[model samples]
Target: MPRVRALSGPKPRDAPEPSHPMPRHLRTLTALLRRAETVTLLAVLCVAGGLWAFAALAAEMLEGDLHVFDETLLMALRRAGDPARPIGGPHLEIVMRDITALGGITVLTLVTISAMVYLVLRRQRASALFLAVAVLGGQVLSRIAKAGFARPRPDLVPHGVDVTSASFPSGHSMMAAVTYLTLAVMLARQEPAWPIRAFFVVVAALLAISVGLSRVYLGVHWPSDVLAGWALGAAWALLVWLVARWMGRRGGIEPDRARPE
Candidate 1:
């Protein structure tokens, strides 16, 4: 007698069995590798594009092509016949100063130190070290670039804030981008949730952007300076992130949460 089927139960669907199990396992690995490659490629493109933009801006600035462009924008922020005052009045100037302070050396130093301590406590020594290098490296690069360019600050208006460095790239803006973005990526990569990662990245980006704008608003930096700062900073952060990610995969650094196989 044939075995009786259970009519109330759902019937199992047939899946063909491969003669070897290797192919099935290989397919999953292949898919994972493809996804990883795609992501890395995109990151490389972003880094390259940012560097290219920075170069273009630098060339134009050196040729004096951005002089009128920078002057027009900088002067527009002042009150008519009052190059000493910003258009938004004393209160707006105050607000801008406060916002700009977010990118200042004191604030960034405090933030980086705090983060490094937290990472140390968490035993993420490699990541903490990487963050430090990323930020400090950006600072070094900023100083070198400024010295190389030797560009002067905007003299079109009395600066809303004090500035004493070369004005080709706003140090505050560049540091803000480097510190915030690097920290954001370090924190985001450790988390498994996409929304959490997105939140960190978005907030970091906004902070960097606001700092750059505040520089221009304060009349301490040429518009091109802020733009160049952002470009270089972003590229630096991404390049460091790529290196960190690569190291993480090799177990040379604190690895991210394991990718799905």
Candidate 2:
């Protein structure tokens, strides 16, 4: 009876334990996103392949197809917008004309000059080099497609714009799209703010698209030609973006600048 010793200090409980597993809904959502990404990649590859095939077909029927399509679109645009007729405002006509000029040397020079300046400022020699390759690669692809197709420019429509290159897919359209899209990617990398980034990208894309459309409005290219240009140009742009992303991940290259938070 010196203090009665406790029979047992403690006893283990034998009851079910609470579970804290991840919610099924969240798990399902995660899996869905991953699956979506995979599907998107597959679709991109399919589009690229399809564009390449179409480019080949266009090449085969280049001169003939360009002539027919250009004529048809010319009539449609003339009835729709009538660049020459001009609805009323002098400003509108001037604006449209200016946009028409955008697909030519002006846009190319702008992008090249800007890229050069960016490289000089940021000291991103590798990125600059890759950018150059992407631009030239797009150009070369355009030329090869044109040469292979040997499509002539529109004669029926009385070309509103001058031409030199063979025209299955519009060269100006391709170049403008590639250049603008490339610049968009570069800026997107540097600017993290989604709204600002989206604004710039949309602006660039719109400018490119307008320039391409202006060609048709001007009675120079077929709608199909411009469309093909867009597809091919977009494919090349995505290819460049993938390259940049790869380089960044590997730490071999840094984008032009960091997005300011």
Candidate 3:
């Protein structure tokens, strides 16, 4: 008989030894990581909407398009005969001042420092550094916006609080949103439970809202200013959160249980 040609051609050279012999578990991890990154990118894109809102508001304000709206809201909060008198009487003013103090520089600084210290002691050094950068960068942005706009304070009503800064965006509202929201997001990442995470974010949002409202009630910030501050601050907070998530994915910081390494 003629020499029989090998039926299988040397077993197809051992099936070419599979170029990437990744383990099942490793492959699963890779898929999960890609999903996580996709989520982070989507979140950042959504946050851009908030920044766009702020830009729109600023543009409107500059064109005097919002003057009537701002004046209406500001005046509505005051007595018809006397613009100096806020609707809630003296006692309410005192309460508002106290609430406003919660967003004051002293309180925010203390809170930030305490939180950073706690994170540092827990050996989450990267997170602590991130917190500082978030807050300080926000402050810088606030200052630049104030100087750039040089918007005058509301002359229509007597300010309920001693005021000094340019009034295009409320510093109290913006800073409060930045500090509290950033802290809440970082803390939420450590907890795996959905309700707990929701609680953190919701409470942070309430605090920011209250601070912004107080600025308007106190006859200091124009309603539009408060709205702009909220928009910008929220965008900044979300940006910081996205940075944390991105960093965690790269193993540059302590990985979160939420990310599932």
Candidate 4:
């Protein structure tokens, strides 16, 4: 019996363990990316809807249907006897002129160039290029819109400033929105604080609004023109931002790294 001990079977090697689950950080990043994508999509849809609504209004205006509305608004900004005098008096006219310049080609171009140079100096080449393209493309688009609509500047009131361009969509208003919003987004991305980001966005919006209103007050653009500009410009800026964000996530552009507390 002692010599009859059975030989022990060789031990089976431990089965290779299943691959580890994805890292927690990676999972978090994936979830954040999905959320960002959803938000971007929703924003784009809303922008498109706004642009469509504004475009419809512009079309009505071009058909001479919004004449009364546009004339009423333009006339209201002037004195009863004098179309030359805006409601806010001489000093206010000066102020409005100054504000309107913020959206002018020269001013906006300088701002864009300055921002681009700053980004380049920061080594944000992609961001600089993104900004340049957004602004230049906006300029081109504004020109095309003007040519396509071929609407005339308002004759209901006297002009506060000299303007010579088609007026279905105010180039000043649209460019203001495109430039300010794009710049604001670029600046805000550098900061991590929500309040700071909101401030940048709010300021940009206010500037765009003021510029559009100036055009109306000056009687160079109809209300619908400004509205259309705001809509289209906003849509363009948002579209550009979404593209940049997607590219950054894919490592095609520089990431906006989280700021240290």
Best by lDDT: 1
Model 4 residue 150 CA deviation (Å) reads 1.0
Query: What is the per-residue lDDT of model 4 for residues 1-261, given as tens digits with 9 covering 90 to 100?
Result: 368877889987799879999998898889877977797889889778867976798779867898888788888899998887789888988889999999999999999999899889988898888889888998998999989998888886778899888997889999999999988888777668868987988999999999999999888999989988998899888877777777877987677654433
lDDT of 2 by residue, 41-93 (tens): 87579557847856664664544544555556667555345445423355555
Give lDDT per model, in order: 0.89, 0.71, 0.87, 0.86
Q: Which 10-residue span in candidate 1 carries the lowest summed lDDT?
A: 16-25
Off by over 4 Å in 1: 1-29, 258-261
- Kindly list the per-residue Cα lDDT of model 1 for residues 187-244, writing each as its tens digit: 8777777788879889999999999989999989999999999999999999988998
**Alpha-carbon runs more than 4 Å astray in model 4:** 1-31, 258-261
In order of appearance, the predictions have TM-scores of 0.87, 0.73, 0.84, 0.85
lDDT of 2 at 105: 70
Local lDDT at 238 for model 2: 71
Top candidate on TM-score is 1
So what's the TM-score on candidate 2? 0.73
Clashes of each: 0, 3, 0, 0
lDDT of 3 by residue, 203-253 (tens): 989998998888998988999999999999999999988888878879877
What lDDT score is found at residue 179 in candidate 3? 89
Q: For each candidate, C-alpha RMSD in Å? A: 7.5, 6.6, 5.0, 6.0
Instruction: Report model 3's TM-score to 2 decimal places.
Output: 0.84
What ranking of all candidate models by TM-score puts the best one first?
A: 1, 4, 3, 2
Candidate scoring better on lDDT of 1 and 4? 1
